[model samples]
Target: MPIRRRLGYLPALVLIFFLCVLLYAFQLHSLISTSRSIDGIEQTADQLDNYKDEPPNKAQLKLQNSPLENEADTADKALLESPVQDWVKFVRLSDDIFLYSVILDLRDGNMDYPCVRIVAIVRRRQSITCNFAGNSSVAASFYELSENHGLSYGAFVLSCKIPQQIKPETVTSFIVQQDETKTYVNVQYTVTEKVPPSMPLTYGICIPVLYGSRYGAANLVEFMELNRIIGAGHVFIYLQHDRLSAEMIKVVNYYKAKRMLTTLEFKLPVSEQIIWYYGQLLAIQDCLYRNMGFAKYLAFQDLDELFVPYSSENIVSMLNPLFSANSSLASLRIPTRYIKASEEELAHPPLAMKLTMAAEAEDVLFTKCVVRPEMVFEQGIHHTSRVIQHHYQTVALPSSFGQLHHYKNYPSSVSNERVPKTYGKKFLARYEQVISELQVKS
Candidate 1:
């Protein structure tokens, strides 16, 4: 029983201790990584705020500058023969004339109207006539279809606007043939995007809000409130009565507010009584009834968020197939919190926000933000969809409007000379109903 005998197990004990530590560290790291991912969605800077647009490097892709023509150009024919490899885009500077400008999508909103590179393409004339069944005489108008170079199959000018309910198998358009003979391009396209059972609800908007707009950077609520007044829809239509905030509202001029509203397809018929929250609810009902099969961007942003669908021209094109597969569900926005201040205004280096176990050590993660229609709902007030995201395709909408204009997002504006206490008071006025409702029982 000497001291040496007791020390015999020391080596085994040390190995066991090391193994335990390794396992513990691995588990801890995993937990910490998962925790951070749940809260943070944005990955980095340098991303366009277009959260749902497709991903393509404009450099590598072969972009169509004008419509591809099967026939040779007599005048601009010489310009059409350039063997360009980049994703080139061109516009007809002149209608009948052949002045073309080559454009590139720099992929940033700040870069207005990209630098236009002039290119040459000959414009040819093909005499063609179009015939389609129409009560109001078949009209003809010219539209440049391809941005590539020439007409793939002659200029497919639309004769007349087709009715929404009717589907015409063939559309007739008059084309000018090099031949003085009368000919027409039988433009045919199946009616895509079935009107979605009259989604009385056309507009869509969502925000991750609870009691307040604390989640966003600042002033997010103000934007939501403004969106409420402007009413959500395409540029033409404006809805009233239906509120997008789930937060209970007092008996005020407005009804209940929610993060989202869809009255486009409500079981209830559209009536003046429920004006406040009708259209938004209908949109939701329409999506559920007829638009469930509609895989395209089923949702859109409230007025402020610019949503451009895939311009690939293919009818059934997917935005980013790698991320938006038919995995248990659908489209997602890989949200990124892009700082708005210019490089000169940047007070700190651009770093993606991440949660850390130790105050110093930070780790990046993949935050899954799968946003869908069913996942979108009105829990009580503000409108929002459960977000889904991926690295390459999704974008965080950078806003000077301060995260949809929330009061909490005011810190950035604090330093601005333009902001005064009165402005803040007016914003709070928008939410007066919600404040009163949440005040107390006594």
Candidate 2:
């Protein structure tokens, strides 16, 4: 009886042991599966951390499905299909009037709506019709931009409000209609868009119309080198193509190839009726708007003029501190120091190093400006005509900082002084390099 009872107890113990082993195996399987799940979650988190700054492919997929992407596609399509207009030459609209460009002006603080400004050289006052997209038409208001120089034909900006139903960005072209002697003439102009967001250039030089045959390639090369040495990132020249020489064109093409110069072909429809230089203000307006969102600061002066710093190596170094100190500074009025070119120098133009004799600082009337283009509404040859007055101010820089070295022929009786030798050595080195390069190229 005792043996039989012991055998019954053994079987029961074996059954309990088997049940414990099964429970242990089940727990080990669950633990391994949970560990794998945790590892996967950590890997996913690491991937997110790696792409925190820049979105991953998944994010791009989301953007591709967004409404903003659709809008961008539509804008791109509209731009591609828009009619191509010649923006380089002045289009003849009538006998006495010519259109230069059509620009979307959104800088008006007082007006609630945007307007299209038609840049033209109008000899006489006349009413014109501006036709927009969707068959909308409005009478344009004329604003004369003469700086009181008393030229027969001057720059006029014909402004017409954009139709409320039409979007400004969608506007690619507009038609101008003028009634002349019971006959109507219609001319279409491509509209230049508003300012962009990215500014790639920090400093630029705007040279008014180069219309005379007197300027040679040598002097132009010297001027460009000098300005480049003094921190001119880009130079914009409005070339009256028919007026300039082949040598000048070659030099322009060389600089353009290097991406340092941009030339806009400029011509007058009726050159005899208008003084050639009188259209400088019009070129300035075009350049101002062209560089509005492209360059941070633009120097408005001729090829013969240069901004020379007193102590700093470049103009940017001298002005950076001032800008940092005064955020509202819109322009810097650099006093002019006239450097009289001798007869010999004029006959055979010498390098900037040879031209040292300069005049004392002149009054504000003879000053030129380096302006922040976005802050200026209307620019003049020597100053800004219209600026956002509420937040912007023009400061006249002292001679100690810098001066505009104007190299030209002056009367012998005028007092003379030596230009500060701040940049003479550096300019000489760079000028020599440029001469050597030109000689090699030739």
Candidate 3:
């Protein structure tokens, strides 16, 4: 009887085991279906994210394809495609040639013959070719500046006329080709119209390259203060970076921070071989073009020189009458009086007051000028080389009205006379105030 009962329980146990297996199988099938549903939802979300809407309306399309927008896109594309170059750095073409900048010449009267002028330091004999946009190439006309001082390398203005089919404003970059060499040089400076109808600055001064470590903080401070007192609103100084002293750099940075001065790094590809400041002519010409249509009046002088007004308080006060009197006057040639200052006097705070004795005005070796920049084409160290012909004239300023005081070391044989005392008191007062402000800032 016991054996039969044990056999009957085995069949029931087998039935329970089969039921459990069926329940587990059903749960696994439900989980697989849920996972497939989630994957399908994710696929739908991805399709919605990437779905494209209808095309834009006609008005929107017109705006997107406007002429101005197309032109801007063209310019942007050209710039992106061109090789990168620093605007202010010189681009070397040959062993003996270096190009500084290229400017679009669109002076009011000369729009018919629009051209681009390249300021360069190059050998006179080498021929240059200008390759413009659209693959058009032309020979460049070379006009050497007269103030090269017989150096092997000299300042030159290379000009090329714009093609009739091409618009002047659209030509942004060009390549230079030398006749003797096969290498083509890409001009670092982009051709653009820098001139505007009017500018905020009344007076601007351009100082040639300050090379060697001779000039220090004191020299810069005195120069800046005197110019400020005389109504110079802006000043540009070309600095030889490697040769400048750390103290001078600090002073330059200070004035730059005040927005009173702009210092450009000036270096020649052949600095070791060039004569004393041969690159200054290129620098001044660059400055002249840079100041055009900006400064009402621009003066060219060195750090040791100051233009003093005798009858008026500032340069503008003296210049207004001259401009009003002669409508055709483009520049004023100021007479210079060289004053000898001892080392002790130069080391003092106020250089103008301490160095009162000056050489006669007749002994001036070279005179400097204050010019209307738009009227002048090229500038030399002492005078303008070319002006807008027939429309402008350069006049000699009388000594009684004003003079440039050039502080330098002179021979003992030169006669020394006391400088005019007309503006001495005013200059001293302004100098003291400037010095105090500088001290406070430091």
lDDT of candidates 1 onward, in order = 0.28, 0.68, 0.69
Per-residue lDDT tens digits for candidate 3, residues 68-121, read 322121222222222322125678777767888677775543322467778888
lDDT of 3 at 361: 45
Clashes of each: 87, 0, 0
Q: Alpha carbon lDDT of residue 398, candidate 2?
A: 89
lDDT, candidate 3, at 176: 79
Q: Which parts of model 1 have CA positions greater than 4 angstroms off?
A: 1-90, 93-157, 160-196, 200-232, 236-428, 431-442
TM-score of each model, paired residue for residue: 0.23, 0.72, 0.72
lDDT of 2 by residue, 285-317 (tens): 888776666677888888777787775867878
Which rank order by TM-score, best down to worst? 2, 3, 1
Error of model 3, residue 263, in angstroms: 0.2
Which candidate, 1 or 3, would have the higher TM-score against the true structure?
3
| Native-referenced Cα lDDT, model 1 | 0.28
Which candidate leads the pack in lDDT? 3
Candidate 2 off by > 4 Å? 1-87, 108-113, 180-198, 276-278, 388-391, 411-420, 440-442
